[model samples]
Target: MKPITMLALACLALSGCKNEEPAASVPSVELRGRLEVDQEKTSARQAQGIEGEYFRRVLTVDGSDMTLDAFINHYCPADTRDETCQKALRIKKIDDVSGATRFLPQGL
Candidate 1:
């Protein structure tokens, strides 16, 4: 039996199997909250393996509890309302929320 012939037959036998059920999806809920920023992203940590800066926030959406993480190129520890601070975060908001940042409560 030739290798090419055997391979063709194997593929033919496997093609009949089909998934009967649709993929399950998670329900999404509207959430709003404050950010618990971890101020540990010094120059040394980033080089080691830490990914940018990370923040942890607990949000209960529709009765379920969960934690979320956020990263940034720069975070303004100063007043988030400061024009200078918001200007810094502009890059992140435009680029899928992965750049300059300042953690602020929901209302500003």
Candidate 2:
């Protein structure tokens, strides 16, 4: 009886260890946006990574033509008027203009 009880406890613990996070599907399209005047490329990526709380590849944007620093300033300002836009401004490198970039929250 003792062994059975211990086994049950172990099983419960093991089951709890399973990854509970929902599996977020990778984005099929690319993301895009021009940097705001006050932000730079590197700063933008750093901000995005921090905001997302994970290193997501899709978050990285390329061919921005706009620096990360400039975007941060114009879009992600300290006194952002729009909380929705502020939350939406995630970290990412512009990959391709052909499609839209995907943003997935890892819930980290």
Candidate 3:
């Protein structure tokens, strides 16, 4: 084989051997904002003495609601394989708050 042909074939083989993986999908901006707003609303309800102890226990710790970013970092940090965290992140509606809270640790 010609030297140039050999070189081209080697490059093609190397390219095929690349171990690149697909990039992780990031949460959409709308979803992020919605989660933050939900947290804020929960906090407000708690302040008004309307929210229940279960919500207070799950969503708030140290007498404060966990910010959306903090919750995501704590529950679903990068490369986390926890089933509860995955389920929590999948929650899409405000009505699902109860379900999501179930994924969190209680008494904290």
Candidate 4:
């Protein structure tokens, strides 16, 4: 057998014996924020003939304004429209939220 071939086989064997242990899973943080209706945007949507409620949730995190929608998209899987629904987040909790609780907006 060639030296290069032997070296390659030895390296492969060593890699196989390396740690197979699973990495520790980090807990997700769930944030709680005020679910307020954005009437101005809603009105704009109506003017444009779009039907539906327009919402912008504001949450203060570490003394900064954070968009709840942004966090949800980052933490949850999106649908075809590139949007994450409440049901999806409820089904699967991911990423760091404040209270580790699922966010659900009423009548949305």
Order the candidate numbers by lDDT, best to worst. Answer: 4, 3, 1, 2
Best by lDDT: 4
By TM-score, the candidates rank as 4, 3, 1, 2
Q: List, residue by residue over 31-72, the lDDT tens digit for candidate 1.
A: 233344445543445778766665444445457555332212
- C-alpha lDDT values of all predictions: 0.44, 0.41, 0.49, 0.52
Residue-level lDDT of model 4, residues 1-108, one tens digit each, is: 699999999999998998765532222333455545678877987899988766555556456665565555554444423223453354224322322233445522
lDDT of 1 at 41: 42
lDDT of 2 by residue, 1-108 (tens): 999999999999999999776633322223233322223444575676733222223223343343333444444546554543343444332322212234345521
Pairs clashing within candidate 4: 29-97, 30-97, 30-98, 30-99, 30-100, 31-98
Compare candidates 2 and 4 on TM-score and give the better one: 4
Model 4 TM-score, all chains together: 0.34
User: What TM-score, over all chains together, does every model reach?
Assistant: 0.26, 0.23, 0.30, 0.34
Instruction: Please report the candidate that would top TM-score against the real structure.
Output: 4
Candidate 4 shows a clash count of: 6
Each candidate: RMSD = 13.6, 15.9, 10.1, 10.0
TM-score between candidate 1 and the true structure = 0.26
lDDT of 1 at 93: 48
lDDT of 4 at 37: 61
| Stretches of model 1 off by over 4 angstroms after superposition | 1-16, 39-54, 69-108
- Which sections of candidate 3 miss by over 4 Å? 25-27, 35-108
